[model samples]
Target: MSGSHVRLEPLTMDHAAGLLEAGADPGIWAWLSSRQPVELGEAEAIVKAALTDPDRRAWAQIDLASGRFAGTTSYYQIVAKHRILSIGHTWIGAGFQRTALNTEAKFLLLRNAFESWGAQRVAWETDARNLRSQRAIERLGALREGLLRAHRIRPDGTSRDTVLYSMTDAEWPGARARLLARLG
Candidate 1:
């Protein structure tokens, strides 16, 4: 579960404090999947429950430079047989944005998926209106697969069109090189 610039460490009771600290981000929550929790107590429950889910792989994001907990990212919709996976539920404090933190985190995940897990395709989906996220995923060299119209109920309980992006094993070499260049 460890990434290059961050570690996707297994979530545990001991991680409550770090989870709370990471979730303290208020600015980024507006466009994220769920709202940021208000207190350390609330984050603990959320992180704990997210980890207990059988279908998803969740982890804490650790910022290498500050040695501080940054946030959480997970691989959902993992179809091992099909070699497909999705990275979502990701959030980072303003301080960690545009840094090597996210690039390396993604590198690790992609590396593990394509090389370690033998996954053929890695997917990243976001609200179509979230231009920032769309750019970031594209920056990682994912192809603009298409948009899912009214794909899911948003945090505000409204339907949302999801932009789907993906990188396949055939594309991993270029994608990894791009991510590495940024991190370097």
Candidate 2:
């Protein structure tokens, strides 16, 4: 999917080097559920798995001006029959954080999910400790649904409390307007 300053292409093995470059800062992965890849080989493995994941679709975010990889995102826990899906596993390199890159990237994804797919709801959940992510979700006009205590097991074997958020079909009009204003 393409946006003014950012675009998302299918995640592929070819993006390994770009992922490594974008993820150079170790702190980028601090609150992520997946393990941080410390080497190109590890990044390659992760990309390989994402490419073949049956239940999810992954995309590599690209910086339009520089044509560089910025991060990765995915549509996970998809339930087509119910017209629901969760957008998670998103991370942007430190350089792109706080910029409109994230806003537009999200705008594109949400547009696709709701407008194109006719989804009734789109969900997001983040580690309870991730204040940045929490704020971002709220900024996108998603409602704080609730908390799921010990919702997931992290890569390091620790249980994580997840804070849930969502935007329903009824809420999308307002959310879309807000996102578009941010993108502007």
**TM-scores for all predictions:** 0.93, 0.97
Candidate 1's residue-wise lDDT over 1-184, tens digit each?
5555777776676777877776676777877766677877777778777878787888778887677888778899998789899998888877788877887888888998899999999999999999999998988899899999989997789999999999999999988887777877
Q: What would the per-residue lDDT of candidate 2 be over residues 42-65, giving only the tens digit for each residue?
A: 999889888788888999999999
Candidate 1: where are CA atoms >4 Å away? 1-4
Please give the CA lDDT of all the candidate structures: 0.83, 0.92
Clashing pairs in 1: none
- Relative to the true structure, candidate 1 reaches a TM of 0.93
What pairs collide in candidate 2?
none
The top-ranked prediction according to lDDT is 2
Q: What lDDT score is found at residue 99 in candidate 1?
A: 78
